[model samples]
Every structure is written in C-alpha cells, then in structure tokens.
Target: MMRKVFSIIIFVFMLSIISTAYAKKVNKEINVVISVDKNRVEIGNHIRLTVGVEGAFDTDIPELSVPESFSLMYGPSVSTQTTIINNVVKVFRGFMYGFSPSENGKFEIGPVTLKYKGKRYTSNSINIEVVERTPFESTIDEGTDRSGKRVDINKMVFVELVTDKAEAYIYEEIIQSFKLYFQKGLPIDDLDYVAASTKSFLAEKLGDERRYEEVRDGILYNVIELRTALFPLVSGKIEIPPAKFKCNIIIRQQRNRGSMFEEFMGGGGRRYPVERSTEPVKLLIKQLPEVDKPEDFAGAVGKYTMDVLAKPAKVKIGDPITLSINIRGEGNIQTIGEPLLAPDGMNNFKDYDYETKVTITDRGDGIRGEKLFHKVIEPQSEDVDFIPGISFSYFDPDIETYKTLTHEPVPIEIEHSDIETPIRLSLESAGLAKGKVKILTKDILPLMTDLYSFKNQGVAIYKRPVLLSIIFLIPILIVVACVYVQRQRALLSNDVGYARKKHAMAHAQKHLSNARGLLQLDNPPEFYATLAGTILKHIADKLNVTSASVTSDNIYDILEKRGVSNEVIKGLRQCLESCDYGRFSSGQLSREQMESTLETAEKVIVQLEKQL
Candidate 1:
C-alpha cells in the first residue's frame, strides 16, 4: 500500500511540473508584426494589410496610419489561432485591413502600434508600389510564376476590351466587346461587373452573356463575353473608360488528419478575392464626309432599303389615302428620320404628320431592325391620276456615299360624286297661304282646375343633402388626386434618393423571392449571390449609394453612423460572410443550413429596415 501511494505522489508531482512548464510557455513574450499580401499593386486595386500579435490574449485594437493616397476600403476583421506542439502552447491574434490606392506612387503602409499589459508595442512599416497599369499588362511579354516557370497571365485570368473598328463615323454602329477569360475548371463566383462609361455615345446591350471555351497562348481557358452596340454622338477622340469586375476564387487545401474517416470527409477551402480591369479604349470619330452628300440626308448612317405602299388605289376626289413606308436594314434604326414627300406628290395632295413605329432585333452579331412610317394623304383635285412615289435618302457608311431609294408611283382611279342635291322651294312659290294655324287635335281630357294638382312636377335634386355632398366632394377629390399625382411625379423626377429609398423595401423583397426560388432549384451559388446582392442593394438604396461600393469592411461604419446597433451590424456581417462562403466554397450546404441562412437574412433585413 505504501508503494502504491508513493507512485501516486510521483505522478501528481510530475503533472504539476508539466502544468507549470505549459503555463510558462502559454505566457510567452508578446510580439507584434505588420505585413502586406503584396508589396506591388495597381491603382484602383485592393491590398490586404495584417497586424499579428503573438502570445497575447487581451490587446487593444491597433492604431494604423496609412498614406494620404490610400483609402481604407474595409477591415479590422479579427482572427484568432491557437496551437499545441511538443508540450508548448502558442496563441496568435490578428487584425486585417483592406485598402485601395487612389493615386499611383510608392508609399509606406504603417508602423502599427498596439497596447497590452500596460505596455506599448510597435510593428514594422511595409513598403508598397502602386502603378498606373496592372503588373499583368507590363509583364505579358516576360514574367515568371512563383515556381520560377515562364507563364502567360492570360492563361490564369484576364479581361479584354475589343472593338469591331478603331475608327468610325458619327452615328455609325460600333460593336464593343468585353471578354473575361479564366483557366479551365477554375472555381469562381460572386462576380460584380462594372461596365465602361459610354457617356459620349448611345449604347445598347446586344444580347445576354455568352460563354464558350478558347485557347490562348496554347493554354485552354473558359470565356465569358458581353457585347454592346455603341453609336458615337459627337466627332472627336472619345475615350471609353475601363471595365472592371471583382470575384472570389476558391483554393482547396488538403489536411493530414491521420485518420481514414477524417480524410474521407474532405479538406477545407478558402476564398481569395481578385479584381481585374480592362484597358481603356480610344476611338477616333470622324464627321460624315461632305463631298457628294445628299441634301435630304437625315443623319442616317447604315445600310438600308425603303419600301412604300399606298392603299386604296381607287378613290373619289377629296378622299384619303394611307401611305406605309418601311425602312429596314442593319444600323441605328431608332434614329432614322422621317422620309420627305416628293415634290410632285406634294402639289396634288395634302399630307399630315406621319406616325412612327420602331422595332429592333439583336442577332447576337449586330443590331438589325426596322422603322415603319404611316402617312395620310388626301387628293384635292379630280385630275390627280396616281399617288406620287416616296423617296428616302441616307448616308451609307460602308460605301462611304449617299444613296436615295425611290419607289414607283402607285396608280389610282378617281371618280366624281354621283349623288345630286335636292332643290328647296320658297313658301310663296309653293302657293300655300300662311296664317294662324287652328288646333290639330282636341285634348284627351280637360285641364284640372284644382291648384293642388299643379304641384311642382319634379323634386329639386340640388336641395337633397346626399346629392349636394356628393357634388361638393367630387371636385375636392379631383383636386386632391391632382395634387398627389403631381407631387409623386416631381419626387420621382427630381429626388432620386427619395425615390430609391421609398422603393428599397419592395426591391429587396423581390430579390428575396427570387432567391427563394433559386433555393428550390437547388442552386446554392445563385441563391447566395441573389441574397447577398439584395442585402447590399437594400443598404445602398437607403444610403443613396451604389451597391458595388458597399463592402463588409465599410458597411459597419456606414451603418453605425446612421445609429445602428452593434448587435445588428454583427448579424449582418455574419450573413454576408455566410453568403460568401456558400458562393465560392466547393462544399455543398445541407438543406437545413441553407434554410437557416435564408431565415437569418430575412430577420436581419427586417431589423435594418426598421432602423433605417
């Protein structure tokens, strides 16, 4: 019994020694360090800044100073990590920030300072280089990957801005294509596209997005292409701003679990955000050539053909005729002006303003459509034999000349009125004497002499209370309705912020319903995308800002400034992060998880609506 007791004492003493050693390791010296994901970045691109603290449990948030040229997009996302190895314990905590540079230059990010245990700790500063163009653009011809292998940037991911022609005449159709290329089998999601600004042109989307595969630099890649038809409004060197998009790429990492069950389950993954932009495009717009230009040119620039049809070939003098003129071809159909009446046809008939109808068809390659004009003409004289032909003149940019299309005159026969008018006779010519007429018939009954029988034949409707009330109420209602309608119109026209705020709830609900439908379809990616967009859009509408500008980093501050509670903001952040995980991660969520996420989103949005 004494031996067993001695053994117990030995075990207890050894455990105490081990525990003390572990405690000492856990209480290691505090160290802080600052670093950036990339030292070199392009203007308008984002960089990640992280400040990590080692062997610290309680520390104040770091105070970071960024250069004037850089702006804080979002951050201070907190992360914690703990590990135990060989009887040693280590603890780490980090605060991350996302920043974008507004100007191009070399700048220092920070020498972040943190306070812990009544002591101050300073982190090393990081240097960054911000260039006007992306590294991919400058290094396309010569670049080495991290593995020291020469690789083309286009093989991984890139964007291209292409135009059908570099130069075009004013009002000519120019097809602009924005294409995104990524390596085959790449996992990407949460795409936010920013279209190029075409303020100096009239632009129309050609069709839906097109997806296909192509080989570039002997590497296979998947491509998404969007096309737009742009018609230059002015003649000069016009610049189209670069188009941009942000997306998240999923990277799967394997884990050494040392167990078959854990290995079978799967490895985890992370999302890396990426932003790409196309180079700005420049186009020279020339004025339509003046040499050999048609006098009646109505600024129409495209290939076109016109057909004229006049109905009612047979008509009487002063009768009306309908002229149907159809101008159809490939071009800017909406801008085609009305054709003029022929001089020969104008003298013999009177014409009225023509009614116009335009139809556009997008054939995926270009813009093709037709414009129809309905004109009414009336014959004024019997000598008119045929309806005059109509002429349409337009400048054809392909041939670089003016062309006039003329239709043959429509033949018609006119007949004079055959009905004769009856003659009127005077009383004297009729030989009938005019005098005081005698009674034609006797009254059926003698008039009542009693005064009671002569009571008011009809009741006075104006004296009735209900009728008077209705009559007075109608005009008041009309005036109120008129005022209400005018106020709504004015608000919609002038106060965009008010309009958006008023409709924000409805728009959010609509998107939610769409997301729910997507959920039923078992498309988690699309559902999450829709839900995320709805939340961002709702806040943007309330704040009168663009949805693309909102991010997790800035939304907290944005909401807090408007007096939102921390609890609600945290809930929103969780919802956003869940949606992002659902979008880019390779793992599929269970139905129950998806439903819970959806419910949480609804609840948070409801809370936001009330506060906002």
Candidate 2:
C-alpha cells in the first residue's frame, strides 16, 4: 500500500510539471501587420490594403485609420486561412480594403491597435502617394515610327464612365454607365468578361448593352455602353470604380529586323494586348431625410405609376387567378421590392405562391423603365367581389418629397362551381353481365368498344363528283410547287437581303426547335452557338450587311435609321447579348435558363419584325 501511494504522488508531480511546460510554450501575443499593394496610384486607381493578424481566432479587425484625404470605396474583403502540421496549428486572418484618392497628395495611414484575449497588438504606419490620372498608350497601327518604336493608341482609344445625375440622396436611384470608344474594330468578347462592380452601391443591371455612334471632337467612335441602376447604400461621397476591360485591342506590332522576311514568310498581322480599363467616376450622395418619411414606402426612390390587373376577369370560384402588378416610370424600378398593400387587399384569397416573378425593362430614356411582378392566388371568400386598391410609395429624388401612387381596384367575377366527384362504373351495370354468354379464352382478344368510327360509316365516297374532280387539281398543285421552289432559289442566289429577310423567321424557328432537343440532351456549348448565330445572322441579313460586319458597334445606328422602335431596339440588343452570354458563360446553366434564353431570342426577332 505504501508503494502504490508513492507511485500516485510521483504521477501527480509529473502531470503538474507538464501543465506548467505547456502553459509556458503557448504564445499568447498576436502579430498584426499592415501592407499596401501600391505606394502610388492614379487618381481613379484603387489602392489596396491588407491588414493581417497572426495567431488570432476570435479577434476583431484592426482599425485601418485611413487619413481624411482618402475615400474608402470598398472595404474589408475578408479572408481567412489555416494550416496545421505536427499538432501545431497556425491561423492567418486578413481584411482587404480598396481606397481611392480624393486629392493628389501623400498620406499616412496608421499605427492601428487591436486587442485579443487580454493581449494588445499594434501595426506599423504606412505611407501612400497619389497622382493625377494618366492616359494609357493610346494609338497603335500596323506601322512602326522612325524611333523604331510602335505608336501607342493613347487618346485615340479610351474608356469613360458617364452618369446623368451628379448628386443623389442615400438609397436614391442613379444611372451609372461605362462607355468604350474606339476608332477601329475590336474583338469585344475579350471585354465581355469586364463587368461593373457595384461595391459602393446596391445595383440592378439594366438589360443588354447599347451600341451607337458618337462623333466626339471630330472623331467618329464606335461606342459600347454598359449601364446599371445604382442606389447608394450609405450616405457619403462614392467613387465608382472603373470597369477593367480585357480584350485583344488591335495594336501595331513593332517590326523587328526580320519584319520584311517574316511578312514574306506569311506572318503579317497586328499584335493585341489582353486588358484595358476606363476612368473611375465620383458621385455625391447626401443622407436621406429622417423626418416626414411615409410608412408605406418600401425603399422606392423613383417616379412611378402602378397598375393592378387580374387574369381572366370572369372566373369560377375554385379557379386560380394570376394577379399582375406593373409599375412604370423613371428611376430604380427593379429595386422596388414587394409593394405595400393594405391589410384588406386580397384578403379573400387563401392560396398564394411563395414566389414572385419580377421583370424589368429599360425604356429608351436612359434608366427610366418598367417593372412587372406576378402573383397567383385562389379566391376563398364568397362575399368579396373585388380586390382593394393597392398603393406604392416612393421618395422622388427629383421632387425631393414623398409621393404615393395608387392603383384602382380590380373587379373579379366569381361563379359558383359544382363540386365534382368521379363515379366509378359498377361491373354489373356497365354492360359486363356476369352470366351473359361470355367466354374466357387465352387466344381470343377482347373486342374494342368502337372498332369503326360511326360518324363517317356508310358515306358514299365513290359516287361524289367532287372526289372525281380532286385528281385534276393535283397536277396544277405540283406545277405551282415546282415554280415556287425555282423562284425562291433564284431570289436567294441573287438578293441576299431579300432572301435573308424572307427566311429569317423560318430559320429562327428551326434553330429554336433544334435547341429544344439539344437542351434535353444537355448540350450547352453547341446550343448557345446555334442560338447566337440565328440572331446575328438574321439581323445581318435584315440590314443587308455581311455577318462579319454585323457587330454590336453599328447596330443601334442602323436600327434607328431603319425606323425601329427604341423599345424594340433595346430588346433586340439585349436578346442578342443574352445569346452570346449563354454560349460563352463558363458556369453550367439549368434547363430553365436555357429555355428562357431561347424564348427571349424568339421574342426579340418577332418584335423586330413587328416594329419594322
């Protein structure tokens, strides 16, 4: 017993020693460091900063303590990584911020301090320099200069971001857009990946980019536009970042010493770069009023009118009714969420879908447009005859006041529907007599109820004079079919525009039908290609331009001259782009998406014909 007690005492002493050693080895101090991506940047360029903390799990991000002269465009793009080896785990947490210089100068950013688990840490200060925006190498041609250097396409080709309004209230709708101007043709697919980052604002992308001609400073430029409906998330001065475009812009390749020999060897072409960017823009967003705000306003910041409608005005009591709520006007139509309806409105309906179909359209007047919302409901109350008036409230940034738009009540006519219960046929009464001379045989088949259609039975077919005369019309029909084919072939061979215009509808339909089958087979790439070609080819033929020259750059001007409705023109442009995106998007899309894209393309083509 004494020996056992001595063993226990020694074990307890060793455990105490191990505990003290572990406590001494665990480092409690966290290391915090601040690093900047670049010390100097153009006025619109983003200066990135990373705040890193070591050995931290439950620690707050250290304050960046940026100087007053810088504008924080976006912040705290958070990232965390962890690694463990030999039972020792290491964790690194980082926060990234993008800042734009408000004025050209040198600035110092902080000795920021942070605390974690009763321990304090500090980061060293950082210095940043800002300079005025510089133009990129602007002009490049297929020729070399006397200095043996290629000319840069500096001012000749550049990008600019434009907006209609200079100032807005917080959460107010603003139209922000980017435009690329070029003197020569470019491969736009390279820039297709370029997208507007709405880091500083809540945004809804306006459908399809618009392309048009703008003669700026006596230079006719091919312009491509990308637009967004932006609402400031916070009240402050916001600097909208430039859209980084990466495309193989045709630049002049410098001719080396072997240029003449290489050209003779069939290597003659221009060199292209991989990326380009537009200048950033700034907008002043003032704080919205805290007082005199309406209760019904559901974050709407535009001038709009509301229209309420019920499908199938006359309906049986048990039938489902589709309710359409449409809002049209200027401002952020898509940003307007669920409309604020009175409690009594649609109280008679008990069944409703949990989802709503919301669609937005841009009416040629910049971002001013239309929004549609759909909801399905079934009537449950017998006494209610109509849906009550619904109201939508919005703060008009232009008027600087709150305005409420009300839609009139939609009347619903409900008729009593008789309850239906299917009655099963009784074996004894449904002509299957139990003992009526019936034979059960393995080889015999059951008789069909109507082996022959009685409606045409016993009609005199051979005696009719019209039947005898039908054969005489056959030869004439064959001759007419042959003549029509010959005429069509001749026209198709001679007049390209007429031939294309005539068969555009048929070709589009055939492509869509083919895509339906492809969708079932899960073929995305080929499906997108065929669909895009259908639209592009159709438009090219309609404009009498070769498919190679029928590009987005010159489409708007041509359509406008051809007297197409602006609305239809916009829809066509959006649909064409939708096809391109469907073909080129890297992510796998669902059957529904593929189907929707096909439908949009068809609608655009049909509408184009109508508008023409």
Candidate 3:
C-alpha cells in the first residue's frame, strides 16, 4: 500500500511538470511577419503586405495602426491554416493588407506590433520609396501570373463610351454603348455608374448581362456592356462627360507559394482580397452640321426612302384599310424617334392601329436593317377620301446633305356612295297652307285640341305592404331560432390524415408550377432550387414533420418507412444532389437534364402521395 501511494505521487508530479512546460512555451510564442514585393511606391499605386502570426494559443493579433504616408486601399483579409502531424496540431493565421502611398516620398510602413499570450511582438520596419508617376507610367505587374503572362491591369478596368454615329443632327438619335473589360483572371462583383450628361442624353442599362472567360492572349476577363439612346439637346459640339464607376475586382493569392502543392491538395489557391476600378474615361462628342439642312428634316441620319402601300385602293365604307408606311433605311434605324402622321386624310377614322417591325442581319460593310411601320385605319364616313402624298425627310450623311422623299398619293373609290340617301324637297308654294301659317305660342284661347288635358300634373301617395312585412318577419324568426337546440354532433370530425393529404397535394402542385416556370426559362440553378424546395416542403407537410427538422437523413428515413418505393427515393436523392451541386458548387446542368429533373420531381411527389 505504501509503494502504491508513492507511485501515485510521482505520476502527479510528472503531470504538473508537463503542464508547466506547455504554459511557458505558449507564453513565448508570439510572432508578426511583414513582407512586400518592392521597396518603392508611387502616387495612385498599391503595394501588398502580408502579416502572419506563427504561434498564439487562443489569441488574435493586435489591431494595426497604419502610417499617414500610406493609405489602406483594401484588407486586412484574414486566412487560417491548420496542420496535424504525428498528433500535433498547429494553426497559422495570415492577414493581407494593401497600401497605396498618398504622394511621392520616402515612407515607413510599420513596426506593426501584435500582442498574444501576454507578450508583444513587433515586425521589422520597411522603408518604401514612392516616386511621382510619369506621363507614361505603369503599375506593378505583380509578376507573371500562373500562365507566365502579364496584363496591363490599368487597361483591364476602364469605362468607354462608344457611339454608333459620332455626328448626329439635333433631333436625331445616336446609339451609345458603354463597355467594361477586365483583365485575365479578374472577377468583378458589381458596377456603379455616375455623372451622366443630364436630360440631354437618355442613358439606360441595356441588359443585366455579363460574361467571363479566358481570352486567346492568356488573360481571364469579364466584359459588361451598357447601352443608351443619346439625342443631342443642342446642335454644336456636345461633350459627353466622363462616367465614373466603382468596381470590385476579386484579388486572389497563392496558398502555399507554388503550383505543385496547390494542384495536389485541392487548395487551388483562393480569392483572398478585392481591388476596385481606379479611374474614369472621357469621350469627344460632335453634333451634326447645320449646313444645307432641310427645313422639314425629321432628324433622320441614314439613306432611306418612303413608300405607302394600301391593302385596298377601293373599298366600302366599313371595310378595313391597312396603310403600311415603309421607311427603308441604312443607318440609325433602331434609334428612330416616334413617327408622326398627318390626320387630315384619316378624318372620321374610328381606330388607328400601328405596329413597328425591325429586322437586322449581316449586309455588305456591316450589320444593317430595315424597319416597316404598318397602320390600320377604319373610316366611319361614306364620302370618298384621298390619302395625299406624304413627305419624309432624312439627313443623307454620305452626301453631307439632307433629302426629302415623297410617297405617292392613294385614291380610294367608295362603293357605298349611296349609303347617305338624299332627302326630297317639294316646292308646292301658294297653297291653302300659306294662309293658315300662324304662331301657336301667341297665347290664343284654348280650342277643342286642348279640351281633353285638364290637369296632368298632380301628386299622389301610396304605401307598399311588402317592405313592412319583411322588416317584421326577420326579427320574429331570430327569436324563434334562440329556443332551438343546435345539432352539435352532426359536424364531421376532422380527419388529420385527409387534411395532410389535402395540404400536401396543394403544396405539391405549387412546387410543380414553380419548377415548370423555372424550366421554361432554362435556368438550371433556379429550376433545381424550386424543384427541391417544393418536394421537401411537401414531404415535410405530409409526414407531419417541421420544416426545420427535415434533414436529408431524416427525410429519407421517413419516406422509406412510409413505404415509398426505392426508385422514387433514388430520384429524390438525385434531385437533391443536383440542387446542392448547382447551388453550392460549380456544376452546371444542361437544359435536357433540367427538364428531366423537373419531370422526375413531379413523379416522385406523386408517388409519395400514393404511399401516404
């Protein structure tokens, strides 16, 4: 017994020593690392710095105070790495910071300090030489990328205003498109545009569309396009001001310094930070010349001819007439303003209907198109009307002058000329009626014609018995029902299972509808999301389980116990997987796959309903 007591004391003492040693080691392990690619900086330029903490037990790095000469352009984004080897765990935390020098000078970037485990650690001071940017200066390339290529990062992000026609007349329309191009391997979050030319230009974002890909030059780029319809407010040189935009470009970093480990560990690097668009761009806009301008010019800028085509040159009064105004043009057809028509020829027309059709295709020099305007008119009068010749004026930019084209007049021969029957007027004067012509309102004495109407205006009163009877009977019936015994047990008891089935079927149809719409749009992500959400909600409702508790495992167990077929269960799992992948991962499903998934979901829901 004494020897056992001694052994226990020795073991306890050993444990205490081991714990003390660990405590000391933790107290001394505080680290801060600062690194940069260059010792120099410049105005409107950025330099990257990486701060790391090597060994801190349950402690975070202290907040850093940046110098006045440097501006913190971006993070301080943090990342952590953990390793377990031989049953020993080690965690390393890293923070990346970007600094842009405010002006050209010699700047000191720290003595950045960190306190951990009751100890303070300071990084080595770094002196950066900031130089003024020359007229032709380039930013740091950050070395050749993984593809051994460098892109002009400055040019990758810029705003450009492109006009289809630089010179357009005062009332003419110019198609202006704004485009943004990102460099290879660059991903941007969103774009915010400011500083428009006010009411002078009608600017609008054409479509919420974007595309990203690696170009032939080994640069990954994202391109966005915005369009606007610009009509010059004035006639002279109109300058389109620079449009400023703020774009968030994803900044990426290497995980383990090189490619071999990244490819092997599936680390594949990560987007560790972000950079924003830096500058705005300007465009020189010129207005069309007023020389030789036509007095009746309709602000057209292309070569065009006008033609009036009528369905029927001669028709009845009620017949419909389709008068097509065809303006075949070669330039700025899509930007044509609202067309106006003179209504003098269309008088008495009940309804005036018009439609515009534009077709574009590759023709000769570039893309060109023709637009046709069709107007349907219905005349209400019987008189024959004439559609006089219409004149269309357009600026012929090729010849540096304006020209007016006239459509030939069209005459309509109305077959219903006799629809208005003429009244006959008889001239049988000097008859016996001429001597008897007298005024009737001259207050003559009442004759035999007025003897029957003695008094036609007299007030009379009569009481109706129907309204009084209803008013007395409704309340007497209420008093009679107060003494009657209500049938308390006749109502059917609520069937919980039937209610569940009813709700399940209703919700299932809702899910099916959502999936159908998503499928029609060919959106795989939304299709799968709606499809999976609908099925899961229906199952939860049918099984009497709360939606929050409907995990994949829980759902599978419930469905299997409910005698759901293996095939249907398998399809449910497939749908869930597809949704998970398309939503959380980079897997994209084809249109056929989306349609199949939608159909399969419906079948599975129907089968589940059968089992229930």
Candidate 4:
C-alpha cells in the first residue's frame, strides 16, 4: 500500500512538470499579422499599419477602442491557422485593423487585449509616424516635354479621332468619338461632370450612358464611350479641346502584423493608397480635300449603293401602299442624307416620318445603320394618276462622279362603274300621264312652298353600288395557329439541341447570303467582313463561347468534342480559314466560288445536324 501511494505521488509530480514546461513554451511564442491601407490620410497618399499579439492563449478578441489622433477605416479581421511542422503544432489567432493619421504626427495604435484559456494577453503599443508628403512625378507625364501642348492628362477624359479615308473629296465623313473613363477606387462623397466646347464641327451626340470593359495599351479600364457624329464645318484642319474633371480618392496603408493567419488570408499582403483623377485630354483633326468634288455630293463618302423596294404593283383606290427604300452599301450609313419625295397633285401624300436603326461592326469601322422613312398618301381625284418618283443623290468617291437615282413612277388605272340603270324618266313624259289621270288639290294645303324647296329632295342618299366582302379572317388565324403548333411540335419532337443546330444552319446560310450580296455589289472587303462576322457569331453562340474565346483551335476542339463528323468539321474549319484570309487579304472570290462556299456550309450544317 505505501509503494502504491509513492508511485501515485511521483506520477503527479511528473505531470506537473510537463504542464509547467508547456505553459513556459506557450508564453514565449508570438503570432503577428500586418496590414496597410488608406483612411483619412493626406491627399494622393496611402496609410499603412501592422497588428500583432504575443501570448500563450487561444483568445477571442474584443474590438479595439481607437483614439482621436487617427481614424480607423476597416479591421477586426479575425483569423486562426494551425500549422504542424515536425509534430510541433503552432496555433495562431488574433484580429487586424487599419487606421490613417488625421494629422501629421506620431500616432499610437493600441494596447489591444485578448482573452484565451481564462487568461488575458495584451499587445505592445505600436507608434506610426506620419509626415507631410512632397509632390511626386505623375505616372504618365512627369518631367516630360511641356513645349508641345500642355493638355490636362488623367484617367477621366480622353479623345480618339479617326478618319475613314485620310484623302477624299470635300463632304467626306471623318468620324471622331470622344470617350471618358472614370473610377472612384476610394470612398467618394459626391461627383459632378461638365462638358467643354466642340468647335468648327457639326456634332450630333449619340447613345445614352453606357459602361463597358476596355483595354488600351496594357491597362484594363472600365470605359464609357460617348460618341458624336462630326461633320467638318470647313474643308481644313480643326482641333478639338479636352474635357476635364475633379474627384476624391481614399488612401490607407498597413502598419503592423497582428495575426499570421489574418496575414495569410488577407492575400498575405498590406493595403496601399489610391488616387483619383483631375485631368483632361485633347484631339487634333484634319479635313479632306475640296478639289475635284462632285456637285451632287452632300457629304456621303466611302462606297455605297441605293436599293428601293415598293409593295403592291397593282392596287385599287383607297388601298395603303408601303414603300421600303434600303440604301445598303458601307461607307457612312449613319450620316447619309434622307431620301426626298417630289410634290405631285395626283397622290395627296402627307409629310414623311423618319426612324433609324444602327448595327456596328466588331472592327473599328465608321458606322452601320438603316435609315427608314414612312409616308402615307391619298388619291385626290378618280382620274388615273401616278405616284411621283423619289430622287436619291450622292457622290460616288470611287467613280469620282455625282450619281442620282430616279425611281420609276407608279401608275394607277381608275375603271368606270359597271352597275348602271337601263331606264330613264322625264318630267314631260310624266305630264302626259298626268293629263290622262285626275288632277286633285287639297284646300287645306296652304302655299307655304316658299319656305321649302322640293328641287333637291328627289336625289338618292347613296348613288354608288356597295360591294359585299366576307373575309374568312378566322380561317386565316386558324391556319397561322396550325403553322405555329406544327413548328412547335416538330421542334419538340426532335432533340431540342438538334433543333437548335438546325436553326444555326439558317445563320450559316445568312452569312453566305451576305457574302453573295457584297460580292454582287462589288465590295470585296465588306463581303468578307459580313461573311466572317456572321459565321463567327453563329459558331460562338452555338458553342456558348464568348467572341474573344472563339479561336480556330478552340472551335475545332469544341466541334470534335461534340462528336461532329470529321469530314464536315474539316470543311467548316476550311471555310473559317478562308473567311479569315479573304477578310485580311481583301481577296475577291468569284460568284461561282462564293456559291460553292454556300453549298459547302449547307452540306456541313446538314451533316452536323444529323450527327447531333
């Protein structure tokens, strides 16, 4: 019994000794986390700081009470990490906070406290020295040449000017789009913008506010393009002034390391100051030549052709006729003048109403759009009259001559009415019958005939014959419903994805049509561009890939993965490559060659649809 008691006493003593050793080791270890960022720091400056804790404890930290000398921006980012190296586990825990000096001085951070395992652990007070910052060089132009133009340069306002052709006749269009990119990385209280003057140009602003991602040089910027259509006031050089603005940005920095885990999780780095923009930019413009300019030119340039379409070559009176004029050839489609209609007494047409729709290319072309005008007219007389022809005049830069389009006038034939009376009556013939009959007069009927006239009373209310029309509109609606239901049933019956592929087949055909149209119009560049864009957009939509990600290899990989036939896939790849070559090299494909491409795309779509 005494030996057992002695053994127990020795065991207790050994455990006590191990506990003391562990406590000593824990007291000696420390975990540190550092952070740096801006909060109430000086303008165009960043504030930095670090947070640390030294104790033998697993602690839940209370929030730090900051002083008036510094302003705390963000913090109390608590973290914990346990690392086992060589079986020796090191557990770290604490919170980090960032603050900036309100005024230039030495500011004390904290005697931050934490409680772990029923014990209080206090951090050593940290001192951050803040000093007045001297002016530094600008990132873009600091100590650069000031002799040229001293334009206010910064992030917000900038100008980009481009011309369709550097050399052209007067009235040729030169496009200049001014874009402004702005960002408030720091906390901003408020913001306002002011636009400067645009001189010596007819500026028509286009589009509402829009934001998009843009990369210039190597910097990624969120850009908003504010566009304006500019027509040169005179045939000479013109300079555009820069726009300007002022904005606020916050600055902060990490001071000290507090929790190592917080350091690792917070990107394992410190925060820094951010600066806002207070600058502007300028643009230089040059004008086209006035020499050898055509008289019919009204500022239309590049290459173009006018197409006119009118409905119902044969129609009766009181029928509404629709005229669709499409002026489709590249050059500046947006800036083209509205087609005019001449005055005629035959068809009493009202004033024309106008509307425009725009489609811009992925490449940096001038503009693409369709201008529409709607006109309503009524016939003034029953005589056969003609609707006057419209005149569309523009200068052909390639031909260097004025061209005028005089559309053929529409003729109307008014036929005499077939429903007419066979018998005729006269007052003298009625008198001969009256002499044979008894003539009677009422004495009560007084001679009040002066107050009323029976001369116009015998005329009929409606002299013209009315034709009956019983249109079976319900049957037409039923037919439409049948078509829609049949289409839906067909689509649903097939694999939905396969049906989608079949639809994509139409898009490929459309690309071929665009190519044919361009070739027939004698425009090789636009022919290839339209063909390439149509095919690329179609493929991208099919594979659910972004336009930027649709490279040739990626397309092939996607197609092969989808189990497309190797033969069809090869032909598709070849078509895309051909489009690319034609686009870049401006290679002209013959009509037969273009038709063959259409046939190839059709075959490929068919084969792929079957496989799918």
Error of 1 at 303 (Å): 1.3
Q: Rank all candidate structures by their TM-score, best first, as comma-separated numbers.
A: 1, 3, 2, 4
Q: lDDT for model 2, on a 0 to 1 scale?
A: 0.69
Query: What are the runs in model 1 whose C-alpha is more than 4 Å off?
Result: 1-155, 256-267, 418-612
Query: Candidate 2: minimum summed lDDT over ten consecutive residues — where?
Result: 260-269
Pick the lDDT winner: 1
Question: Each prediction's TM-score against the native?
Answer: 0.49, 0.39, 0.40, 0.34
Clashing pairs in 1: 74-553
How far residue 121's Cα lies from its native spot in candidate 4, in Å, is: 49
lDDT of each: 0.78, 0.69, 0.61, 0.52
Q: On a 0 to 100 scale, what is the lDDT of residue 330 in model 4? A: 49
Candidate 1 residue-wise lDDT, 156-243, digit = tens: 6689998999999999999999998876655565567889999999887797668897755333468889899999999999999999
In model 4, how large is the Cα lDDT of residue 248?
31
Write the residue-wise lDDT of candidate 3 on 374-407 in tens digits. Answer: 7776667767566655667787656667787776
Give candidate 4 regions above 4 Å deviation. Answer: 1-135, 138-173, 179-191, 206-224, 255-312, 315-367, 374-391, 396-612
Clash count, predicted structure 1: 1
RMSD list, candidates in order = 20.2, 32.2, 24.1, 28.3
